[model samples]
Target chain A: MRPSDIAFRLYLVALFTFVFLPILTSMVFSLNSDRFPTVPLGEFTTHWYKTAFSRPEVWTAFGNSLIVAVCAAALSTALGFVTAYTDFRYGFRFKPAYLALALLPPTIPLVIMGLAMLAWLGRLGISGTLSGIVVAHTVMGAPFAMAICRLRLSQMDPALEAAAWNLGASQWRAMRAVVIPFCLPALISAYCLTAAVSFDEFIVAWFVSGLNKTVPVMILEILQGNVDPQINAIGTVVFLTSMALVIVAQLLILRKTNA
Target chain B: MTDTDPLVRFSGVRKTYGTFEAVKHLDLDIGRGEFVAIMGPSGCGKTTTLRMLAGLEEPTAGEITIDGKRMNEVSAHDRDTPLVWQSLALFPFLNVKENVEFGLKMRGVSKPDRHGRAMLWLERLGLKGFETRRIDQLSGGQRQRVALARSLVTEPRMLLLDEPLSALDAHLVIRMQGVLTRLQKELGITFVYVTHSQSEAFAMADRVVIMGHGEIAQIGKPQEIFRAPKNRFVAEFVGRNNILPGKTPGQEIVVAADRMQVSASDPGEGALPAEFLSEEFAGTGIICYFEGPEGVELKAQVTEDQLENLAPEPGQRFWLTWAPGAAHVMAGT
Candidate 1:
């Protein structure tokens, strides 16, 4: 290879290493039998993984996280699809304002959002519950879903829907048959991404999930008490699962767009 | 529909979007089973008029009637008028068969019947073997045929085409034009085709509607409109006509360059001073370019026989003349 090509490849390797080094380190340390994470290798064992899997608290928190993530993902995706479709297909007053508001959640700090939601949910008498956590995660994750779905909707030709309407389909039927199908891949990708975000989310869950601790909040609590190798194993599992979800979503989007 | 009743009628129809009037005081009558083409430059409201007929756009004033029924408030889906979009707009996710069956499916047709009808159209449009192929897998012409089949399967009262063949290659355009004409005749359906190409409009339409500045400049048979344009805009837009300053009885006149006969006699007050610039041999004839009075560039279509007889060269000063009756006189010209 040319010198420039070698330099470029090296640069890319450095970038990847920089980004993935922490996750790689964590994965390696999860397999180590050492009490504290260190560079020098200790005896390798699956004891921490077994401990993590066997714990009832861990299983409960994992179950709670799954429920919140799934619910949040579905709600956010549906809300995003509605907002994106309406904003794109119709003309209304203060449209920019509406879009800006829809996109505001992702821009604000998660801590601020969590605190605000805690106060809001307290007034509604749903604070410190699974439903409150789901609501909080939906609010946090929806902007990402909306952003992706909006992009897909914007790229779509409005004439497709028009053709459907011209072909004797009512406006609702046209959207159901043509527009929704066209945006399905993006919607799926958005759902997967929001689910991943909700799975890994900590601050909002910490504020709103009072009795029911999500996996991230549980991990934070465990870390605060002691630097257990079990925490490393659980973190590795959560990180890998979130990464897998995001990759699957990305692949689906790419396949649909043929990009 | 009877011969006396117009299938579609636009009476003083006006459409305004905010401050801009897209179509103004338009009156048109489209007969049953007639193929009418609306032609104009961009922003001349030809597409808007077609959309209004299809109930995609509501008229700001006046009335639009289909078979004597008012269509002012009817939605596009309820109106029995389908449009073949310029972009074709085939659903990319659906295969060819599904795309063609979509209209029928929307109307709640059973699966077996929808499949049979879609297959028939696919075969008729020469897309038989490509049934299960995705829209992205088809060629431009094939996709166009699918779009046509998708619209026609429902058997709407009228089919509106908005520059449907604009994206195809020139050769494909000609082939599709013939295909569209054949389909229209076979189906015997009223067609409202909107295009900017004069040749496409003239070739397929029974009558042509020429629009300018959001109003109809002229509406007549293609031959009539070509031979006798009502105004300067129609004359310039419809065909290659060299408009030049001239005079006729009781009206201000301009002579078409091709009709300007060169004569040795004094051509009178109607004649204008002009100098020959260039001549182009266009296979069957020659197009002679000239610089007229006040630097007006003019064109003249000279036959091969005329070119041989006259043998006019560049820089030739001549009295361009024509019979007064042959001159097309425009009002307020």
Candidate 2:
């Protein structure tokens, strides 16, 4: 091949290696029998996995994280779809401002957002609960969902909804019959992405998930208590959960149609 | 309304986008089962007029009535006027059978009944055995037939078409024109078609309404408009005719291209001096462009045999004349 083609291939390999090498190392060390993570001498074993699973707190944290991720994903996708549809279907004086507001949450610093949510939920008397973490994650995750749904809506034929109405479908009926089906791929993608975000989030969960520690929060505590080998086992599971969710999300929307 | 009365009427209707008027005050009456074509240049409010009739746009000023019922407040879904869009707008996510049955399903028709009716239309439109095929798999003409079937399956009293054939091949457009005309006559339903094409309108419409600049320039049978345009705009837009500045001020003469004959030598008195400019072959006929006195531009149609006999080249002097009564004097222009 040409020199530029060879360079491009090398760039891709380097990029993927940079992104995945840390995860691969964690996976490898999770099975190693060595006390400290080092190269060239450890035996392969499932000792860390057994140690991580035996702790009852890790089980509790896993359960808490799963519930928060599910609830947050559902709420974020629902809110995002509405926000996207409103942007797609309406024209008004402040439309640009409205869209900017809809997409604003993701741009805010996570620490500031986490603090704001902690304060707000404490005032509402649900602070330090699983519900508080769910609420906080929903706010942080919604803009990503909205961005995905907006891209899908842009690809849609603008006249499809109007054509449905012209064919005798009522407003609600057209939404069900045309708009929702057209955006189904985007909705599932958004759900998966938001679930992955909530499942793997750290800074925000560390602030609001007080007694109800999620997997990331548990991993941090384990790491700080000592440089525990058990951290690798939990980190591998977290990596797999996130990778599976992300892959599913990408597959749903990236399978091109003859548009 | 009685059988003799108009099925749709627009009285003092006006539509504006902010300060720009898309359709000025308009009054029109469409008889039952009539095929009417509204045509104009782009941005000439032809589509605005069609959209108003279909209840997609609420008129800014007066009223639109379908069969004596005021439709100013009627929502688009409540109207039976199904429009065949220029883009076809077929749902890519839905298969052919599902797309065709969408209207009936929304109207709460039973599943078996909807399926039977949809299948009947699909077959009628020559789309048999393609029911389960996805929209993206169909050809352009097949998708067009699908759009027609979807709109017609509702069996509405009237149908609206907005330049629906603009995207087809020339031969396919001609074929679809035949399909549309035959369907209109067979179903005995009013078809209000909007286009910018003169040929499509004249070929299929019983009457043609020519619009320009948000107003009706003229409305008449195609032959009448061809023979006698109400004004200069209709004269220029509808047919390829020689519009001449008459002998006196405030007068214009319109001669159909076919009516004027060309010759190398002077024919006699009343024959005009002209110079041949260019010629274009149009099927069996050739359109020979000429320039007259005072730089007046004109065109004459001659058969290929006639063009050979004349053998006029660019800048060749010729005599252009017509029968006295063949030229129409458009009074206002």
- Per-candidate iRMSD: 2.2, 1.1
Model 1 captures what fraction of native contacts? 0.87
All-Cα superposition RMSD per candidate: 2.4, 1.3
Q: Give residue A70's error in model 2 in angstroms.
A: 1.3
The numbered model that scores best in DockQ is 2
lDDT of 2 at A206: 92
The DockQ of each candidate is 0.67, 0.79
Candidate 1 docking quality: incorrect, acceptable, medium or high = medium
Clashing pairs in 2: none
Q: Judging by TM-score against the true structure, name the best candidate.
A: 2
Q: Which stretches of candidate 2 lie over 4 Å from their true place?
A: none
lDDT of 1: 0.87
